[model samples]
Target: MDVDDGRTARARPSSWAAVAIGTVAVIWLAFWVLKAVFDVVALLFAGVLLAVFLHGIAGWLSRRAHLPAGWALAVTVAAIVAVLGAGVWLIAPSLAAQVDELSQRLPEAARRVADHIERYAWGRRLVERLSEAQGLPQARQALLGATRLLSTTLGALTGVIVVLFVGLFLAAEPAAYRRGLLRLVPIARRARAATVLDDTGHILRRWMLGKFCSMAAVGVLTWIGLSLLGIRLALALALLAATLTFIPYLGPVLALLPAALLGLLQGPAMAGYVIALYLGIQLVESYLLTPLIQRSTVALPPGLILAMQVLLGALTGGLGVVLATPLLAALVVLVKRVYVEDVLGDATVDQGEGAPLPGLPEQR
Candidate 1:
């Protein structure tokens, strides 16, 4: 008995030491692997998000419309294509006109802007300081360099095609793909994977639907307001706002730029109207629309969004930036449902942040 116990104890210690070493090695390997391949991983997560969201819509349509799931899927796909085609048809004329007008007016606008800058007190002080500090020449060169840098990206065209294809394929047969994945996992983990898939579907659908609703509201408001203000290309700017609204934080800010610029071209008073229009839109979005539509998930915090944007942008270029939040939401849902709910314990009713976002899909 003594010999057997001694041998068992010795073996246990050795096993524990080996396990510790293996754990550290795994951590190191995972760190490097994630660093090296975050873009591909991020894209995969984005795929999962798209799949979940589409499936949710399919399910909803199937339920509410009392159609077969397959037929609902077909309708959903048709709706997506129709929306895209209609948007293109609707905005093409206004966009082309706006582009031509901007092309003609940009030089005059630039000259006027320079003159206005030279007249402004802060602008005059900046000019004087730059001249005194011998910064003007360097600043001009730096401005050109910055413009060049902004114009060039590592990968853009290819990434857009990839995202489009990924989103399309994922939406087509998400259940089959998900089931195949869960089957690959151990039998013990299969249930957990199922729950994760369910949770993910819920979160993604809520997010996409809620955001779309809010964006539509914003677009309608923008279109109506700009039309009222006598702005050129009101439809175009409104469409831009709706499209950019998918981006979060930076989106509305970007919408303001073209609106203000167009307003400036129209007249100083019109510029005020444009700014006021966007501001009013922003107010409505924050106070009314978002509250009504986006009451579920708030998305990840701005800092995390910015960090993911920078990271994904660095890795997969702009596609990563665009899909970052959806990707993050998918990850959070998977982790929460599988780890916190399945492995660690049942999900707490008093869970902090509930689902860590405002637009998480309903459990139903």
Candidate 2:
């Protein structure tokens, strides 16, 4: 009996070691699986953002028009579709022409830039070093890269369609989805999870509203500014600026590159003017417009957002970069609400700025 007891005791440690190894193997597998599916997860998160936007609009309509939630959502969707269809019908031809022109002009513009830089000894050396570093791939390689990019874009379009459908379905019955999600949480923590979800949604909706307003303002202002400066492809440049502005710091810099390249094709003075124009517009947008528009949204730190952009971009490519800001915003809300307030027992942390939580009465 003593020998048997001794044997059992010796077996217990080995069993625990085996259990530990199994747990670690499972975790390692999960990590890789999640990494593989990260892109799909990012796309779904994008859909959730869209759903939040739709819910915000639908909620506003429900409140103002006194329509039922479902009817309000239907109206909102129909109105959006009609507006988009009308806008596309009106602008598609001209925008397409401008885009084609811009694309065709860009290569020439780049060549002109190279010629200009080569005129200077230091600039010539710099260009040579850059070409050497890039390995100066053959035309066939460039063509292949372009073909790959085209295929990627097509894949992205498919993803967008999926996101749109997902968003619509989510927006249609958010409460049902919410309940479904809450079911996964412990019963004791379910209320907190629901609150977190609501807070995150409110923050995201406000951010989107502000962002769209800023994008529209930037597009219009850019078109006007470019037209005043007599830049070719004003429409295309404006559209690019507006779309890129959806990203924060790095985006503005990227948007400037093509514009500057085109400007360089015109002249050095024109390039200077274009640079100044973009900087001025950015200053206005950063200081005046964003403050006014995003007053109701959380004041995210620019450095943090930029860091997230860089990290996510490295990890997940362009989609990661695009969604980084919203993801960061959501993370901030979760940290503030869940970690700081609840876990740490500190309610002094500011939950959000600007307006109160959406669909709730304003606190005195």
Using TM-score, give the best candidate's number: 2
Q: After superposition, how far is residue 114 of candidate 2 from its true place, in Å?
A: 0.6
- Runs with alpha carbons beyond 4 Å of true place in candidate 1: 1-36, 42-46, 64-68, 120-157, 297-299, 314-317, 339-346, 349-364
Model number with the top lDDT: 2
| Per-residue C-alpha lDDT of model 1 across residues 83-195, encoded as one tens digit per residue | 98997898778788986776676576656666789988998887778678865588898998888776554344554556667876777767777888888999987886787
Scanning candidate 1 in windows of ten residues, the lowest lDDT window is 349-358
Clashes of each: 9, 0
In model 1, pairs of residues that clash are: 202-361, 203-361, 296-358, 296-359, 297-357, 297-358, 297-359, 298-357, 298-358
Please give, for residues 35-145, the per-residue lDDT of candidate 2 as tens digits: 678789899999999999999999999999999999999999999999999989999999999999889999998888788789999988999898887785688779989
* Local distance difference test values of all predictions, in order: 0.76, 0.90
All candidates: TM-score? 0.71, 0.84
